[model samples]
Target: MVAKKREWRSGRRSVATKLVQMTRHLVVCEGTETEPRYFGGMKDALGPANGRKIAVVVRGSGRHTLDLFEHAEELCRIAPDPYNHVWLIFDKDDFPSNEFDLVERKCGEVSSSSCTFHALYSNPCFEIWPLLHLRYTTAPMDASSCQKGLVDALKREFNVEYRKNMDGLFSLVDSRRQDAISNVDKLDKHHKSIGNDRPSTMNPSTRVGDIFEELGPYLDKGD
Candidate 1:
């Protein structure tokens, strides 16, 4: 008599599961050290209660913001179908306000054919300063002073020496990046809670929540 074959089960979790248990890669530009700090945590923050799992990657510094478009070009040349969803974030600086059209055009030329691309711009620099300001300060804080206050908060929290004014904020985020990576390892084993609240893809409003909300339809839409 012929024997029946047994089905295989994923008793053991994989590395990607630890990241966000994602089927599609969520590519993000203007990589933030603070915002979307960890893959799992960001997933929790941006994920809806019933939404599918999402994975995130911060491409690099926005100083080379346009380079990300070229990177997308290379990606399309290779697999082409690997990334079904892509989100590009950048700061509005160096270029004039009227130059947004040009930036969007460059991104479109590379990203239009292969994946779903959404370009988000933060004035001056990252929206993190504004987000943090909104969280801590009452009135709107300038990017420069917001940077100072954030650095002070982190320094006080970590008990570290204070650094420069505007640039100090970067250090605060830099410190958190490690914590995020470490948390990834832990999340591999357990469903850990991230940030100050529960994970909800429905509401992407926090600091720079608009970007999260804007990207929501694309991230959660059925294709």
Candidate 2:
């Protein structure tokens, strides 16, 4: 028996709806000034394709390690969909080591199935990231020493004094950003080699370069 073919109405064709996916990053930092400025520069410098595809939004949470982590986690839970990358950029600056460990563990536990938290922590101080752009340093410093070193490095390299905030700080360091990333890798490796991989103990290590690499395509190539 031959089956009859169904008749087509006209020449019209059906099309499937396409869902566009956009990548957005929500950043919460412990600093009130510089972190926002730095990430803002990155967002502003995004190239066209990246600007359309990704977003790097930063907020200053003014919280310590665990508090900052919780703030980022809370924001991730409340933010609308497509804001999947939630990062807490905090320093281990004299905060209790237990708090640092707790923050790290909580951030680690968040899976990507839902919005997740990224702990972009710098041991000692956040200023260590900019200092890495100037030179390779594996020196273990306390918060005071870290601040002093950063101030001296900034003065020597860029002729700018270390203020609590610097306007366009990321752009200032953009030319040598790759160098910073490389140096940070070396620092991280050094820490791991010495078995100081944990947060409070990873003195002089910064996760800033890792975050920068994630958002690099969005930023313009600066000379």
Candidate 3:
């Protein structure tokens, strides 16, 4: 006897065809704040051009790189459906001295076979946004020092109280990111105990298909 082919049903349509038709696209930011600071407000900035919705998911603040890795497979499953076009942004301090590789590995591990990945790097963390702002704007300010220029710009753009608040918040949040790295000793112990990488929920080679395999019934059935 011939094995029956699995068929999915949608209203008056085959679900498998709809799934195949879905456009896969996304702009995934490493940290929560970088996207808003850079691309969120700018309409048509890096527009998909393929008529796909622009979805942005934060991997948490700069501190959540490892956490993001742990949940990478889950993230791929949760991403916008169908088509797979993604841009993964990373900060220079992601793995202290290896941000590029970290971002690359993460994207590779979680991305579907249909998805394409782009990795962009920013140095010293989300401070990349501030650096970019300084590079393009002078207003009689010095661009020789990106950090100093950013500080000066922040001081001038906002009132004294707001400036202080911004600095304090940025520093406080950034410290948490720094702490995430500093706490690696504990992570090492946890990894050794589990006989696997610590803090990350899945191995670096885990694929999006692994997670979606569990969602076979719930997924849309269309091309």
Highest lDDT model number: 2
Over the full model, what C-alpha lDDT does candidate 1 score relative to the true structure?
Answer: 0.44
**Highest TM-score scorer:** 2
lDDT tens per residue, model 3, 165-213: 1324333232232233333333345446667542122111112122122
lDDT of 2 by residue, 119-185 (tens): 7888888888888888888888887787788788888988988876778788888889889888988
| lDDT at 91, model 3 | 48
Model 1 scores worst on lDDT over the 10 consecutive residues at 198-207
lDDT of each: 0.44, 0.79, 0.39
Give per-model TM-scores.
0.44, 0.86, 0.41
Question: What's the C-alpha lDDT at position 195 in model 2?
Answer: 90
**How much does candidate 3 score in TM-score?**
0.41
Q: Candidate 1 vs candidate 2: which has greater lDDT?
A: 2
- Span of ten consecutive residues with least summed lDDT in model 3: 202-211
Any residue pairs clashing in model 2, and if so which?
Answer: 46-218
